[model samples]
Target: MEVKDKIVIVTGAGSGIGRATAIHFAKFGATVVVSDINTESAQKVVDEIISNKGKAIVNKCNVAKFEEVENLVNSTVNEFGKLDVIVNNAGIGPNLLRTHESRLKDWDAVIAVNQTGVFYCMKVALQQFLEQGYGNIVNIASLAGLKASPNNISYSASKFAVVGMTKSAAMEYATKNIRVNAVCPGYTESALLNQLIGAKPEMDAILKSVIPMKRYGKAEEIADAVVWLASDNTRFITGQTITLDGGTSL
Candidate 1:
């Protein structure tokens, strides 16, 4: 759908891909709701959007909490009059740990945020879409969801679940005009990847070497793809994971 003047919601928009996606949507004339766990960060993004002559609002939400997600959707509709699109981009990655070394706490935390959080967002957004007869969802999954990441088993598992959720939800709502899709970014330059590289400095070179492009993907590049997918031009597309990795998976 055309994004101009559409009411959009972007979660985990305090930093990284979420932030970029929120700003990009606003730049395209969408009235964006900048939802993030951090209040200050969310407000900052809202301020940035307003400074650039774009429309935005801040909503502090911890996606792991179902109640908070429900409130987010309710409040968005209350303030904007309707909901058009939602980007379930809020996710967390546990530190790199092998499957055997992984702790239950770490695994649960990752799943709660990355997988279950997306489910909650999708569920609430779909409800509103059903009420309004249309909506769009772009979930930020990961390249790890497609291929095994040896050191980060928890994150991979959770993302894989997100990919599945996206497909299942899309199929169920395809005839209802509610489109659900996913964006799988590989080793993009973001706080998450920087943290991973910080822990294993040697892996930085290894990561770049594996990518045929020999470079890390940019947050804006991924953001561009997200906004495009959220547009009306892709009404025929749903339940697909658009991988943004630089040929690393190949």
Candidate 2:
């Protein structure tokens, strides 16, 4: 699935790995649709991609809202004329607290963004893919999805759900010319991690130590895996998670 010249949509393109992945797709010769909760952030990303001479559009959308997600997909197809890939990267982590002690709001927020959001994006992407007879999905599940992340029960639960959803969908559509896969990044440097680190330094330190690499993964590194998964390189790959956790899962 050479992404070059393809129409791609990436949710949470405002910052972090999503931002990097958006730019990477553009660099690979794809026309990108940048969607985010913040209009300003989404526009900012669009501008940067344009400044780099890449084709892109900014679409402000809240993935948790079905209507917004629908609009995001419709607008992309309206502008680009076709859809080829969708990267569901928008997600929120849990507050650094035990489940019983954590605010219920935090729990709900994590589930809505990290899990439900994936569902919305996938639903829309799959519709277009089935109609066109081609598509690819690279879900950004977390290292937490496959292992325990103490004090972040809500976050872990949402990611784990994403993993399950990706596999189920992949199996359902393996013969539909739509390849679905996920990437489980280990302690990637991102806004969510920074926020959690601020709230609990010791917890962050423990996470880094568990990784065999003993450091946080970079956004571009994760983006690399995402690109491969969306390209012809991984044509036979589906219903699998390429876990790059520096041996954390081992």
Query: What residue runs in model 2 are displaced by over 4 Å at the alpha carbon?
Result: none
Tens digits of per-residue lDDT for model 1, 169-190: 9999999999999999998989
Predicted structure with the largest lDDT when compared to the true one: 1
Which portions of model 1 show Cα errors greater than 4 Å?
A: none
Give the lDDT of residue 211 in candidate 1: 96
* CA-lDDT, candidates in order: 0.93, 0.90
> TM per model?
0.98, 0.96
**C-alpha RMSD (angstroms) for model 1:** 0.9
Best by TM-score: 1
